[model samples]
Target: MAAETDRPAPEALISAFEPDRLLKQDQSGRRIAILGTIHGKQGILTAERAAFATESPEVLKAFHAAITQVTNLGDNDIYRWYLASSGGTNNVTAAAAAQQPPDLKLNLIWPCTESHIKKYSEQVVRMVTETPEIYHDHVRPYMSAKREEGRLNWVFNILEGRTEQEDVILRDEGHRGGAGVAGEYHYDDAFLMLPDLNWDRKTMGSLHLLALVQRRDIWSLRDLKKKHVPWLKYLRQRLLEGTVKMYPELEKDQLKLYVHYQPTYYHFHIHVVNVMLEAGATQATGKAFGLENIISQLETISGDEEAGMADVSLTYFLGEASELWTNVYGPLKRGEKPQAG
Candidate 1:
């Protein structure tokens, strides 16, 4: 397949293919995989269809339309769309709905957002400096005072003492000898309030306050509100407009954007939640879905992560799959594509 730039817009391709006209297949609980091979690659198609049939006869019946393109997935691409209804619950709720499903679900496997990252990075820095009391009072006293005295002899003697008493104290206090202390300590409220600073398990339960302090690009609250916040709002608006225009047959509330933040890496991205609608709802009024949650979550994450001490391990939810795609249609605007895809 050719590069993404070489391909027509995804909306155009999706429109031309008429996905609704494609057959729907049920796969009983088997995984529904979409494979993109070279265009006119009969061998690949044959193999894929055979695998599909073998996996579940119900799936073949539900198999929707497949569009072969020279772009999108790759150059000379044969894109296959395997639609199965039984793999998992859609778990998506329209924003306008008064009641949401107890177990509504969405699957969004994508990167974090830039605004989230920038905001969290700034918050983490502020937490370190502004709330030094949380650290100095609760965390700093635990550090070895002897080390601060520059008494090498005492430090050596302490280190050489392989006694059980020293080991117990060190274990309780962390490596620096403060009881109940970890490598990096943070105010619990400060940490919990910000959802944006928390990434996945890759960042939780660790301390890197010193490292964060050394970084010069940590964002400020004002900068985040002025730059990232507005950008996200703009993105949300664009997505809603584009989806409404492109897929008039679909319900407006079906588009969702699931948002998350990654501060350590300094990047932010969005995941889109998509819902398939029946024909009856095609003429219904469009309603924005997931924008409020996205904004709230971003604010909470950013605020919490940035409220504490430096070198603290940030903890926050990794976000569920459905949450990610709740409001993702914004990037699909006709002429608004990012220079870097």
Candidate 2:
């Protein structure tokens, strides 16, 4: 048996089989290997230089001399040497490569600086007060016709005084064979009128006309596009240049115009102006083929008044057109359907 003092320590006993210690020694060897690799790289560089000297002695001599001269110079002196060398004879040409600009990600930060609530409140007030006359004069007549035709559920009027007696009867089932009640209407003063700014009336009217045409089963989308876009484009150009020229007063007012194809309604119409208006001003206005010169043009094209059934008065056309336009372009009220009436 070995003496207690001569016995190997516990750590020494573990060290013989310790994988961790072995791993540490392996890591140390790896570090030495890395250092040796660096040494080898330096050696490779020297060999490469020697090979270059053998292949191109004059170039190698020039490059070596330049490097030696640069190494001896001070930092500032070295910079000046490099600058001079860049412009000097036998210059080492660096190809001019296109430089890409640094990417600057600009996130637009929109701040709610104005009081929208106040602005909207004022708009509502103006719309409620000023829109009635225009609606009554321009939109109500056609809506009244559609209502009489039993093709519209209700025609709202803000222009006329709201009263229970003024309620336009949209459907009369009591009539024999459902004969339409045309031109029978009234107005009420008690009913609350919706603010015009709350809705886009021109878009509403265009959509309304679209829905009406769709329900009537007249005109395909392609036909509407073919017949309408070109005509509207021409009309729009004419109105901007000719009509506006005729009525130069319109130039003072701000104007925005748009034309869109509504598949469901299958008709083309024009939206003009903004929904909101200043005090004593009008809300958004739209002109439909049914309301504009396109009606007469259609009549001429069809060569029959009945074939071009759009020869109604602007007021008459607008009411029905408004409903269709509203259906397509305006926001709907509760329980409103896009279908006719």
Candidate 3:
């Protein structure tokens, strides 16, 4: 309704929300979608309610008072809790449960339009086979252009401590426990570990984390060279060890570390997730490449320091609506050179 700087406080807007209807709810019951409006807003609000972060104070306090039903999703330590009123009500009536709102996961989009809703809706995905030639000739240029457009400002914001600093679990500023010589690693080689937005942070089985390097030169895994093998190995070990230290309930063996071929951002980052987490499209074989495998590949590659991931082919899937598909692969599929945006 207003410029971001002039927008009302989230608490004020939330208090004034009026739900028009329930739009959808995922089968896991962890997410619920709704169409609604703020008390004074002119346009609809597309909002979603998800499970609260497990470590949140509200969840800790409410866990004892409002839990009416605790249904085990499976033996994998996933459980869904149905909350009743905050008064510690013993009456387990369906109507009472229905009247109570969900716990504290609210993501709101105010003044939302039909186009906004359509953009977020599901889309078709197709598998893409990318040869080294195609990557060097077309995709690399597309990636460079996209990066020049400042798409990674948010990532830089976090890395520079301009925002989301509280969410960082660990920050390693280029020193490998003082083991290496000075200048062996560049100053920008610093990396940090933080929770992924998708994680609830409390579920051991659903743990998701990210390790992002600060250097701007390496755009993705492709930029990794044999010379960077030691750095990669250090990153993998630190990510695993740091996570285990931060979350004692988890062990090194319980974690799965990988890197995405076509990362959402053009930054070299590793995805650290729990082994018990469901293997969704994100973890699918075509999309995720194991860190160990990459290490082994680099160790055995023929060339000197310059030999790297770019020397090989990579196959992955792209959403039909993605710019890569629209501007690159789609054109190539028609027997044409990939077009630039």
Candidate 4:
């Protein structure tokens, strides 16, 4: 396991922030970007790293009470966004502010830097065509190395009930009936759903959820096989039903289900979002593959049950910093044998 690093809470960092300017804001005003300085003197040569402060009880109360002005941005179904302010009347005292930021509710990117700014900002993206040969020869190996390096420790922490237990929306241990029938289902089929970190939990329009499988045999969508169609269908139905049940305002049709090809982590998980949410690059064609489409392909695929996505060619984009790009794809583009991850 990678040694965990001790870091300050977002509240502590926010309390000591010195505002410079609003860097950027988008996502229909659901998010904001600000550039600011902190009082840390350790990194004189390097730019400060960024941190995020979460909403707390005190901050949430002030945020709700300090609305002196409001400008409606737009709405999707029952969801609404606005640009509002407290008219600066609810400002905290200097002493109070100095100790911890005023009663303000805002996300922070503390210890941030110019590099992070560029990373978050838009940049040119290139698409790569990944044939089955490329996947077998390169991508699979790279994924294995990443997993071996303990990159999935955080995922295991959640699965093992070591962290974020309270946030779990639903956990299905593949139980269909009494204990006698439990053996009929594979243990690997067990999964749990949770609110994605990007979600504020209150925004119905921007609803984003994740369903992470308990099994480790399947790393990415590429590992899915025709035999798993039943499991896939079962998962899809439960996820959709569970989300709508959690928020009575949403219908099953309002949710969109998909999985990323080159997912951020190697674990098998599905991304469920409100259809009304804006389709960003994360939902782009080369990245997100619809669960329904994938299932249909699997059902009709001309092969034995063992045949699956591994036999098909997949195309997607990779950041320049990605290990696959630096060690594999980049070398291939230069007409050299790709290096191992």
Q: Largest lDDT belongs to which candidate?
A: 3
Per-residue lDDT of model 2, residues 224-287, tens digit only = 3223333333334433443234334445134444332221122222334321222122222332
lDDT of 4: 0.74
- lDDT (Cα, tens digit) per residue for candidate 4, span 63-133: 56755445444332222344444335537764553454122223334444453465466556667888889
Number of the candidate with higher TM-score, 2 or 4 = 4
Candidate 3 achieves a global lDDT of 0.75
Q: How many steric overlaps are in each model, in order? A: 47, 25, 0, 8
Worst 10 residues of 3 by lDDT: 72-81
Ranking by lDDT: 3, 4, 1, 2
- State the lDDT at 316 in candidate 1: 31
- Residue 195, candidate 3: alpha-carbon lDDT: 78
RMSD of each: 24.5, 32.2, 17.0, 16.7
Taking all chains together, each candidate's TM-score versus the true structure is: 0.25, 0.19, 0.67, 0.66
List, residue by residue over 1-341, the lDDT tens digit for candidate 1. 56867976755643343222212322221222333333323111111122443357665555423211111111111111121233222354434232421211112213434533443342211111113333233323322332244323322222334211221111111122222211333211100001111111122112001001111232221113322333345445544554445445544476555332221122122333344312111112222213455455455543443332132332232212211111111222233432221
Q: What ranges in model 4 sit over 4 Å off?
A: 1-123, 176-188
